[model samples]
Target: MASFATRHIARGTTIRASDCGSLADRGSSLKVEALLGATDQQLRTSGIDYTITAPSFFMQNFISFFTDDYKSGTIYQPVGEEKIGWVDVRDIAAVNAEVLLNPGRYKGRELTITGGESLSYTEAIAIMNERLGATTQFVSITDEAAVEAVSAAQFPEFIIDVMISLNHSIRQGHAEKTTNTVQEVTGRPPITFRQFVDDHRTTWL
Candidate 1:
């Protein structure tokens, strides 16, 4: 978010994300942690932005979990009944690069980015199975069950519960979708999940 602002906002230079696959919603602070965890040199190369983008329901992923999650053979995504906005890294990168190179057209403004489809955890997993031949291999784990499951692990129970809460939020539709954000900036239609799978499924298989 701030990246878009600084290059376009302050420096009057071109800016682009290059990818959003790693981006998460605001509350999912894992992104912040990862960014902060970066070495000083990394930040210097990346350049700091004024403000980061926040999602009403930022469901970038549901895996900001502790080690115990791996034991379950299935990862319970930390999303609830929300239709959060999700942007693919490719789409974000493509748009940002385009806007930055043509700053005269898109500068000093916030752009909402997404894969243009709001997918719930179940819906999202199902698509992977259908299009990419990847089994989601997960069963819905209750918060209490998850808390119990992780109690024996190294992580504190409180942290386990919090992650569960994130999943609950995604199921609830807190994360909405606005496909136009990508279209508005790029002047082209955003790619769909099917296309994403076709392009990358080979690696997974």
Candidate 2:
């Protein structure tokens, strides 16, 4: 069996039996590669036979993880000014299905899936607000304040750190590039941010 892993998980680390549950732990026989954002070097050293890399932040975060912030009309994060290529979860799912079904075809390849455009939080919020007919705003917070807010919300410290780092990565332009891997793999263009917001309008409302 094969399993997915994140880019943050160190290379050569044993697949934890408790990670995604027992079915995910196939011991030495389990195939792991990019999973989420694993670098080429990390995939090469992961000891997995088939490797597929997906690099991009998901646009679904606004609905799932940041719903409260979005609904409350203020998105609090540390990503300032930099633009990010936020791919839709549907597109990512399609690409993952294709890679899993055609393992040999996607093996040893890094698929940098992204939306049709790169947008900063400000730009993305505008699109979403316009699409939803709401007036949500994006507020840029400092890293320390973000961490403190997360902590006050009862999130684990490690996860708080990850959240801060993720915002830092975005603020530094780490996800500014857009790719057509989703179209190439799924045989269709990825959903744009506006399109995504439109499709999930009810959720945002």
Candidate 3:
């Protein structure tokens, strides 16, 4: 039972407990949300691919703990340098396949997986705008005071602060680092944020 974490690394595993209701499944959803930093005690009882995914409005929304301001229409993008480490479901399965083929290398160790580069969500949208010709408007809110002022009247009590807090982390470069785990383990440079967006920009609207 070991543990590993970075600011907001990518965790690319899924739920094994589909029919259980317990502390092991503590989250804001009926489906188990990925906990990027799992404790050693928790690790002892399960097989997991470890990564420390940075918190964002994305995770909060999926877990049913988000305000509408962070949604696609209202804010539409991460405010600053938010680098999300996403483990593509397919890529993760491939890594697991490699480990299964040679168990000795990955038996009791933690590895970092990245979605390649650390680009801001606005940058991501910009990339899409260039390639896909998207015209969705992006409104930039620069400060917590502004976020709170807008959120005070419209947002729920739970997310007024939490949603705005992501702005601080993004602006401070808290999520700007990129790990070479994908290249280190797979012997190839990881893909780019542009590629992922290019591949999936159709879903952006």
**Structural similarity to truth (TM-score) of each candidate:** 0.54, 0.78, 0.51
In candidate 3, what are the lDDT values of residues 1-205, reduced to their tens digit? Answer: 8996532222333221123211222342322232322433365345554332221223222113222332344344346445544334445445555655655566454544445665555665566567756543455556755675757669875455545544544454444545565566667666565665565544544
Sort by lDDT, best first. Answer: 2, 1, 3
Better of 2 and 3 by lDDT: 2
Best by lDDT: 2
The better candidate by TM-score, 1 or 3, is 1
Name the weakest run of 10 consecutive residues (lDDT summed) in model 1.
9-18
User: What shift in Å separates residue 183 of candidate 2 from its native position after superposition?
Assistant: 0.9
lDDT of 3 at 181: 58
Local distance difference test values of all predictions, in order = 0.48, 0.67, 0.45
lDDT of 3 at 151: 78
lDDT of 1 at 197: 53
Clashing pairs in 2: none
